[model samples]
Every structure is written in C-alpha cells, then in structure tokens.
Target chain A: MLVIVMTSIDPLTLVLAIGTPLYLAAAVLYSIRAVRGPTIPDIILAVDCLSYDLAVFLSAIALYYKTPFMTAPPIMLALWVYLLDIYASKYLITREVGV
Target chain B: MIEQVLFWTGSALFIIGGVFDLLGSIGLLRFPSFYVRLHAATIGAIYGAVLPLIGISLIALGSPGIPGNYTIAGASFVTALILLVVAPMGSHVLAHAAHKSKSVSWKPFVDMLEEDEEK
Candidate 1:
C-alpha cells in the first residue's frame, strides 16, 4: 500500500505544471540578455542562477509528475556545477582584461 | 482539513513565485545589458523558486505515506531552507563579482554598492 499508492491531483501540481514553463520563459529572457551582455561574468551569472532555479523547479515537477528520474539531474546540475561555472568564468574574465 | 487548506494556499504562492521566476528569466533575455538581466535573475529566484519550494513542503506534510512522507518532507524542507539562505547570498556574491569584474557596464537605477565603491 505504501509504495504503490498514487495520490490524487493535489492543487500544487498545478503550480509546477504551470510554473515550469513560465519560469523557463523568464530564464530564456534572461539568457537572451546574457547572450548580448557586454561582459562575460554577466552571462555566466545569469546562466548559473537560472540553472539553479531550474533544478529546484525540476524537483517540484518530479514530485507532481511522479517522475524522480527527470528531477535528479537538474538538481545535481544546480547544486554542483552551476556555481563552479560562475566562479571559474569570473576568474577567467579577471585574467582576460584585468577587470 | 486545515493542513489541506494550508497546503493548497502554499501551493498557490509557490506557483505564483515560479511564474515570477519565469518572468524574471524572460526579463533576463529581454533586457539590454548584464546588470539589468541580473535584476531579472535575482527577482526570479527570490519571487519564483523560493516561494514554490515552501509551498511544496506544506503540501508534502499532508501526503499520506510511511517512509515517503518523511523522506520527501525532510529533504524538501532542507532544500527550501538552504535555498532561502543561499540564493540571496549567492546573488550578492555574483553581483559583487560582476561589479568587481566590471561585467555590467550600466544600470537604469541607483546601486547601493555604488556608495560602497566610493568608500
């Protein structure tokens, strides 16, 4: 009973079901700016922060959609490499123009 | 019943927050410069992601389960708490890094760090 039980539609599912697409759109907007950004660190930060949000968003999806498999990788991406990329990119930029 | 209500309310807030986050991301893409995009990214995470995480936790408390309830509730709670603490701090760090690196050239509004930079 415990393992196989599937809960009925919780209202929260509506949150992720709607939220993910909207957030992705917003992220795309931010990324567009990042793409055109005057400096390197700016793009890096946008990508980093968006990826972090995406991970959290994915976790909610996994819960509502009942798909843990879809959630785990994004979670890992946000928690792990996202920040590193920002840091590494910053270091590179600092070296590039001494900014 | 009360738990269910709270769960649903939290869910709405969470979803509302996520929508903001999405908008923030969209704003990031639409904005002309890095600094402006940063505003979108920060508000997106703060308004969008954090709120939803809290809502998810509230909903989890109402779910019936043996271990799944505990597992989901505990992990989600920790994740929410960590994000609440970390997200803003990360934003601050990123902003500082960008400023130091001069990654963003212009801003449409005044900055607190601008005063800090003068000192």
Candidate 2:
C-alpha cells in the first residue's frame, strides 16, 4: 500500500504525502496540551482543536481510499464535538449537565 | 483544463492548511494561558480544518478515478460548512464559561467584563 501510494503522480497523492505528516505532528502537539492542561478550559480548547483537525484528516483518508462511506464520519464527528463544547460550557456555568 | 485547475488549487489549499495546522498546534502548546491559546485554537479550527476539507472536496470533484467521487465531494463540502458555523460558536461559549466561572488564572490589564459586572 505504501509503495503504491508513493508511486502515484497524482496531485492529490503528492498533497497527501506532504500534508498527512504535518497533520499528524499537529495532532501530537494538541494531545500534549490536552493531557497537561492546567485548567478545564485549556483541555477543552485543545480537544476542540484536535477534533477539528481530525475531521480534516478523516476526509483526506477517505479521498485516498476512494471510499464514500468514510466521508460521512467527519461531519458526524464535527457535530458531536460541538455538542461537547456546548455541554461542557453549560456544565461549567450551571454546575450541572442537565438543563 | 478545469480538472487540472481544480486539482492544483486543492493541492495548494491542502499544503496551506497543513502549515497552519502545525503552527496553530505549536501556539496552542506554547501559549502561557488558556485565554491566549484561544487564538491558536481559532486558527486551527478555521484554517487547519475548514480549508483542508474544502480542498478534499475539490480533489474529489477533480479526480475522476475515485469511486463515488461526487459523494465524497458533497460530504466534505457539507462538513466544511458545518465546521465553519460551529467552531467559533463553540469557542465563544467555552471562553465565556471559563471567564464566568473563573476557572483559569490570568492577569488582565483591564478586565472590562469584571468591572462591568461589579458595577
């Protein structure tokens, strides 16, 4: 699989070869912040950044594999992460998760 | 001609997004406070995520060889739009909650929100 992807001269393939590693490095950095954050908001912020980046990654992978099914997950992931932000904020303000 | 244009444009966007992603992540890690890191988060959310999603959609549309390319393009485009609407709102809400709750310690030169609330 690696050899096949590397051999392709497609523009998409070239972009993926360069872009994927950058995204991976970013993900690692975000994870570090998330793990060692001093406050709740810091953790949430790091997580929000990570999730959004992941959505992009997922879409790129879907394109690479030529799979339509994988495209749906990024949207769902983005929606769910937004819900997380809302819920976390609500909890912080009200001191309760429920409405 | 159009396909080549689309492909190259998407490739450029992808590279730009990747660079922004790395920069934002570095800022997120290096920034001293939670409030300061929000700027980095915004960069990561909008440029890092949205741009690449748009690029992916364009690549899908341009690449005829991909199976169900139209579906891939449509879904990625929709995802990018949704993230555009959702990310800032989420960040704002989180920042507001953090401020109100006094969860993070930071030194502000002029805290108008605190001053206003005290009055």
Candidate 3:
C-alpha cells in the first residue's frame, strides 16, 4: 500500500512534503515563545496559536488521507481554542483580584 | 487537464501558506512586545491555517485516488472557514485582556484606549 501510494507524484504528496516541515518549524517557535514568554497572555497566546496550527495540520492530513473523519479533529480543535481564549482571559482578569 | 490545474494550484498555495507560517513564527520569536507577538500569532492562525486548508481541499477534490474526496474537501473548507472566524476573535480577546490587566506594557504612541478610559 505504501509503495503504491508513493509511486505517484500526487498533489497530496506535494502538500504534505512542503507543509509538514513548515508546520514543525512553527511549532518549535511556538514552544520557544511559550517557555520564554514574559507575560501570562503571551504564553496563553502562544498556546492558542499552537492549538490552531495543530488543527490546520490535521485538516491537511485529512485531505492527504482522503478521510472525512479526519476533518472533525480540526473543527473540534478550532472551537476548543476559542473557548480556551475566553476562559484564559477571564482567569487572567479575575486572578488579580484574589477571586 | 482540470485535475492538473487544480494539483498545481494547490501545490502553490501549500508552499505559499507554509512560507507565511514560517515567517509568522519567526516574527513571534523576534517581536519586541506581547501585542506585536499577538499580531504574528494572528498571521500564523489566519494565513497559515486557512490558505493551506484551502490548498488541501483543492488537492483532495482533484485527487482521484482518495475515496469520497469531495466530502474531505468540504470538511477542510468548513474547518478553514471556522479558523478564519475564530482566530482573530481569539487574538482580540487575548489582546484586550492583556491590555486591561497591564500584563505587558505596550506604550503605544496614540494611547487612545487609555485616553478614552480616563474620560
């Protein structure tokens, strides 16, 4: 199966080859920012970006694999990050007041 | 012939989006402030995520080997749209909170928000 899949110069192959490395590089940068971030919001923002990136990567994989089910992960992740943003902000604001 | 067009277009988009994402991440690492970093992150989330998903969808739709490729493409489209909507909103929420809480000193030249709050 792998051999058959690799035999063709498919668009999916091209996308995966070009995109995966770039995403990995971005992830590394995000990790660096998360560790070195001076402020809470900065770290949270990095994490949020990372999650969204993950979703996008998943979407790309779904396309490459031609699996509709794979798309669901990206959708769930995108929505999840939004909620994280809200709650994180709420926590940041409230934590200051001793609440 | 149509598939060839789509395949080439998708490949181009994928490469372009990858470049943007890498640039955004570099900016995130190099930027001076939290707000600037937020800007970079927005670029990553928006251009980085959306464009590539679009490319992937196009590829899926064009590739004959994948079964139910249209369904996969539709899913990618929906995911990309959702990312487009949500990413900026998330950035806004984070930036607003950061500003309000004084988590990071922005020190913008205009200071409109500060003036408005004062008034």
| lDDT computed for candidate 1 | 0.63
> Candidate 3 residues B35-72, lDDT tens each?
77888997898788889888877877777667677887
Total clashing pairs for each candidate? 13, 0, 0
lDDT of 2 by residue, A1-99 (tens): 545645667667667998899999999999999999999889988988999999999999998887788888899998878787788889889988886
Root-mean-square deviation of every model? 4.2, 2.8, 2.7
**What pairs collide in candidate 2?**
none
In model 2, which runs have C-alpha deviations exceeding 4 angstroms?
Answer: A1-9
lDDT for model 3 comes to: 0.81
Top candidate, metric TM-score: 2
Pairs that collide, model 3: none
Residue A34 displacement (Å), model 2: 0.6
Stretches off by above 4 angstroms in model 1 are: A2-4, A7-15, A65-78, A89-99, B65-67, B107-119
TM-score of the B chain in each candidate versus the native B chain: 0.76, 0.96, 0.94
lDDT for B66 in candidate 3 is 72
Q: In model 3, which regions exceed 4 Å deviation?
A: A1-11, A95-99
Candidate 2 vs. true structure, TM-score: 0.93
